[model samples]
Target: MRTRPAGDEEGAGSSTPPAPPVSLLRSGRALLEHIGPYRWRIVLGGLLGLAGAAAAVGQPLAARALIQDLGRHDAVAGALTLLSGLVLLGAVLKALSQYVLAHAAESVVLNARSRLTTRLIRLKVRELERTEPGDLLSRVTSDTTLLRQVTTQSVVSAVTGVLTLIGVVVMMATLDPVLLWTTLAVVVLVGAVISGVLPRISRATAHAQAAVGAMGALLERTLGAIRTVKASGAEERETARVRRAAEDAWHRGVQAAKWQAVMGTAAGLSVQLSFLSVLGVGGARVASGAIEVSTLVAFLLFLFYLMEPVSQLIQAATQFHIGAAAVARLREVELLETDDAPPRPTRTRRRSPAGRPATVVFDKVVFRYRPELPDVHRGVDFEAPGGMTALVGPSGTGKSTVFALLERFYEPTSGRVLVDGRDILTLPLPELRASIGYIEQDAPALSGTLRDNLLLAAPEATEEDVHDVLVRTRLDAFVHALPAGLDTPVGHRGTRLSGGERQRVAIARALLRKPRLLLLDEATSQLDATNELALRDVVVEVARETTVLVIAHRLSTVAMADRIVVMDSGRVRATGTHEELLARDALYRKLAATQLLLPTPEGFTKAEASQG
Candidate 1:
């Protein structure tokens, strides 16, 4: 799939041409703009950097003066003292500057990570489905760290290097213009070589980071399905897959290192060649009596000063290349438009009138997961009016999609989803979600204390509220049996609990929300016959006071629903009580028969009747 530039914000369904790849320079500049809030701190750090540079330049001049006054015994001690003080002060100032810059770098990384995490949480569910967790994680963590180097150390070093280079040149010119010109010629040639290779270095680094992200993606995929991998006896194969990814990353890293080493060599060569040229020419001038011997010595010292900055400049450039590559990845995340934008301000909580269940209506709803995909719901029209309704269908008939549309997780192609006559699209997302409780087929749970997961939907729920839901869901006994009760830790994805217990816990969580409408998708699929019967009774009791919509394959779970909406291929084929459907709908009859619920002369067989 082609992607547009980082700044591009075209609609997902738009027909615009794909944009050209973004340049590293552009990404680097975008990262620089993110540093705006820390401008003052950066400026303070830069000032400290300049002060250190000033000290460096002063030290060379002090050393030159001390060397020139060697014959004057009385002046020697004073010169020595001045030179020693300049060296000591420069060291102290350099240390102070580095400390401040390091602090600023850490702060930028912290802030960048916080912002990325918040944005990641608020991204559109569809966008997130298309993105890998590990790639997103790399951008959040590794990329932000690279940005820190660019913001503090790289920028400061570049500026300081330029300043020092300029100061050294001015001093060199005073000693001898001819030698200075000769030195700059060699430096300029080396710089031309560097400029030619710098862009390639960035490209190599970008490739290297991409490799690392790929490795992370592989690791995440394997670990998330580790049980499956081991169960299939494919651990060795999976290990080989991860090894391949790691090897790719290592190769890319070596390629980047190769380019960086070339840059380092060029930098060192420039300084060394300039030194030799200056020394040879300065020596000839001194021999011809055109310049003083002491001046020649000072000029060579100044040449070494020039060498330091040249080395610093190249090092800073190398860092910029690496950082620019990381910024490209980071911008890929930062540029995407989030689902939550123009954040809603806090307002008084709105409550539904008491004694009324929410009415859900689908008015000719048509939807597909993607524009290019077949429709999941084609002009589908249905309503669940303030009571217990069960949606029954064959697999892939869009039974669960009905709930998804009601929740507005994805927009219908051309239709309306209304909650109590208000279009869900018109409702504030938070309020809309708050009014409805959803439990998915898998019933995922976070790794935390049982109480933490229970209170997630309703933090302000009282002890009585928690106790009531536990008893209602028949989970009270389970919780009480635990060693730590409410504080007992649920292992990752609730591995510590049986599947049936996890389902009950999910139900209890949804109950605490006090929602006007509750959606239960395959809620009892994992339960034993006894527990299923118990939960079915609980569902019936809850539906008396609120609306309940259940998507289920088990005929027993929905045989007594107030209404059964029989669906086929994304359309509602029939709706009525179970007996009516059994008599009138062939699909319902076949489904019931498949479950061995054959009709007797009076009604269903005794065993099937008992099952229902």
Candidate 2:
């Protein structure tokens, strides 16, 4: 089983797969829930839309009257002038209404994307274990864009189309009841075709969007390690991998387009059939003298008007189906569990004496990343009684796992981790993590100003506290040399700074928090002899005030530890002061000789030794 850097789910002997996706209608409704806060605006837009449809309906009725008035010789010219003026006014009002609805549609998109962005940032770390950065980014960007199209264009058009359809039907009935029956028959057929085709559109769109996300994930993985690929002469291989994903996305998109084409064809067919049936029946009525020529002409015009709204309604439904598919992708990320919220402070939290440190105990801990995999920590037991304690072990001996468990990033399969006589699990996550300062082997930094990186853990830290930590960590000179000083921008992952500088920056950031227990994992691995010595002094000095736990990679870093715990094969072999352990433990002596020294012309020299 592959394990993540922190929280990792076990690959069990048996595990049930997740349930199938929710229905498109249910997913569409869930997307609409984001529009609740802007309902008033949407309602206003809808009213304007209805007014536009009302104007559209009135146009044909006026044209029918104009034709009949032209046949009459009485005040014919005057009636034509009035009719022209009314048509112009209706056109202006319709344009204004459409503008208002367009604005409301944009606002809905903004609100939804904002909420989705917030959720993405707060998601729990474990979710990252199962997710890809590129796929998550695609959902945030392109999927949200599709949702915008649905909310603004599709939903608004649907509302206006329905209103126009109703108005056209009313006019048709007034003109002739027999002709209206023919139109309703075509409407029923159109509705049935739409219902069948909409599900197909939805399924195709879902597959297409998923393929796009896969393409994004592949591209992201490649570009993130571009240098490695080039160094290993694997660029051509990686290019082919991304090309395959892109081609897959294209194929899926073509499938969706085919489904949409069928829906569009159905909509057009309904309009043509309705027009033919209306013309056939209306011609018979006029021939039998049941309605006048002018009335039959008006009924035929209304039938043509029905086509516009019906076509729009069908087009809007197609857009909605596509949007619903994208909504499902967005919901997958938005529905993920978020990190633990801040806990209320309680009196039960342990507070030790001045100049002393918090006690840490690992009690019979047994943990494996996966249930089907071998245990990383097997019935482990150890204790650190404050002061400075160094944990020495060979690589893969679970030194880093101890730090992860202490931070509560993942719970042990069984056993308890106690801090100052209190179960760490009983403490709220934020509170437990806040009490301990952890510096990983990489000492990761974000893209930001030096001041921004330093103040991340303690945003409220004052300028004096910042200067104090900088001086203690030996970063003061480096910052002072810069033109912008603390305000200087640190390039991505602090690439602008040397490895030692980056390590010191991470240490300074943690120090500003004033944690009771400090866990340093290979904190000085990147530093040169001079910088390493300076950082060692800083660690020893800090240990006087708080408990310090060091996962020692170099023996020189922990030579003065108050006590040293030597571990092998996931269990502690011995614990004592550094010198005492060196004498009593064979593993300790071997590790010290390898990590602390090298043979020189004079003898074994600690400074000139290659690091173990």
Q: What TM-score goes with each of the models?
A: 0.91, 0.87
Model 1: per-residue Cα lDDT at residue 299: 80
**What lDDT score goes with residue 498 in model 1?**
84
- As for candidate 1, its clashing pairs are none
lDDT of 2 by residue, 1-612 (tens): 123744533222111122235477777687778667666776777776677667667767777777888777555665566667666766777677666666666776677688777777767655666677777888878887886667666777788788888888888888899999988998898789789888888878888777777778778877777768899998988888778778878888899999888988888888889888988888888899998888988887788778888888888888888888888887788778876765564545333325346899999988876567678888788898788999987777788889988887667889989998888879878878878888888888889899999999877777888899999898999999999999999987787888888899989988888888999988888889998898898888889888999987676876878988888888888899876865566666667776645223234345433432
In the range 204-308, model 1's lDDT, one tens digit per residue, is 788877777766777777888878889999898878877887887788889889988999899889878988998899889999999977787778778777888
Clashes per candidate (backbone, < 3 Å) = 0, 1
Highest TM-score against the true fold, candidate: 1
After aligning candidate 2 to the native by TM-score, how far in Å is the CA of 209 from where it should be? Answer: 1.4
Once fitted onto the true fold, the runs of candidate 2 whose alpha carbons sit more than 4 angstroms away are 1-22, 76-104, 153-160, 342-356, 595-612
List the lowest-lDDT window of 10 residues for candidate 2. Answer: 10-19
Which consecutive 10 residues in model 1 have the weakest lDDT in total?
A: 10-19
